[model samples]
Target: MTETSTEGTGTIEALSLVPKAEARQSMKDFKSDQEVRWCPGCGDYAVLAAVQGFMPELGLAKENIVFVSGIGCSSRFPYYMNTYGMHSIHGRAPAIATGLASSRRDLSVWVVTGDGDALSIGGNHLIHALRRNVNLKILLFNNRIYGLTKGQYSPPRRSARSPSRRRWARWTRPSTRCRSPSARRRRSWRGRWTPTASI
Candidate 1:
């Protein structure tokens, strides 16, 4: 008598089987015990809550996520997250996050920065990261003023108020209509390819 292999049958059975239980993990699992220290009415609280709420959807291992931040009010993000993080110098979060993401593909890298911290001292770093398409998520909080620095005017504000009316006019132009044809082409290309690629 010949005996048939049960391995294929077992594999088929496993493939057809459904999960017996729902996920036990909750958003609270990602919540850090650290006290949220943002001032009342600060937008940081909303940003923090949004990040925490969205994080669980990634379903990543807690240790495999990293948050890097520059010196500013929003830079305190790394401290509130339960995952691994680094609070870096002013306007250096993008560079640090780029390094981390490039070196560790298994990790989810996020950079938390403020308008002044990123667009002022870190502008070059931010542009390079975006241009290179670095595998990092940047959360730039633009509150128009420097919150951590006691409400000083920021780079965005300076640009808006500068004597160069031409620059202000260019900046104020509607982005979608004002972009160059090359930029429009790039956007169209990305819109067509990214959806299928993501799936």
Candidate 2:
């Protein structure tokens, strides 16, 4: 915006309408001192890094932001962020985070949950949060998987399963995408294992 003064010397000065940012933090400022334990190529690492980088743009203080996570691979996300966070109960991140947000309106709460942890055990809580229109930033990492424990069914298998998939999934064991076919080979021949996709 510019305005001219005619009373004295005619002059125009530029003024910015935008407010100054509250924080001047770099991406490194958001990084926690703890180590990132996700697998070498896990997509969660990318998500974490992206969120860390994006936080600076918000100009919000790290102390005011909170991250809540439930059980599964993403539950450890809190450990990697410098902001306030909670490793909440299994499938209960939504409920816990909602309560926290409601009670402390000043705090910015973010929910981090994998497909299985959210859609299965925590389905009701997730629905409740959405139905109530609660203020929150929910990060649903829908890789369609439950990679933490091997015995549990995956998100893709449980939520959107066909009848045929149900029958097969019940019998076949669950597996992690991170495991190499060679490392998870079917058999060991001569004390050596080779890659094989066959189950």
Error of 2 at 153 (Å): 3.6
* Tens-digit lDDT track of model 1 for 84-178: 99999988888988887767766667788887888778877877665555456677777767776665566555345555543433343222211
Please list the Cα RMSD from the true structure of every candidate, rounded to 1 decimal place: 12.1, 16.5
Q: Candidate 2 has what TM-score?
A: 0.69
User: What's model 1's lDDT at 128?
Assistant: 66
Model 2 clash pairs? none
Backbone clashes, each candidate: 0, 0
Best by lDDT: 2
User: Per-residue lDDT for 1-199 in model 2, tens only?
Assistant: 1121323121111111113347588999889999899878887887888789888877667888889999988889999999899998989998998788777765667899887887778877876665443455678776655677654466345433666545546454443321324323311111211112121
Report model 1's TM-score to 2 decimal places: 0.69
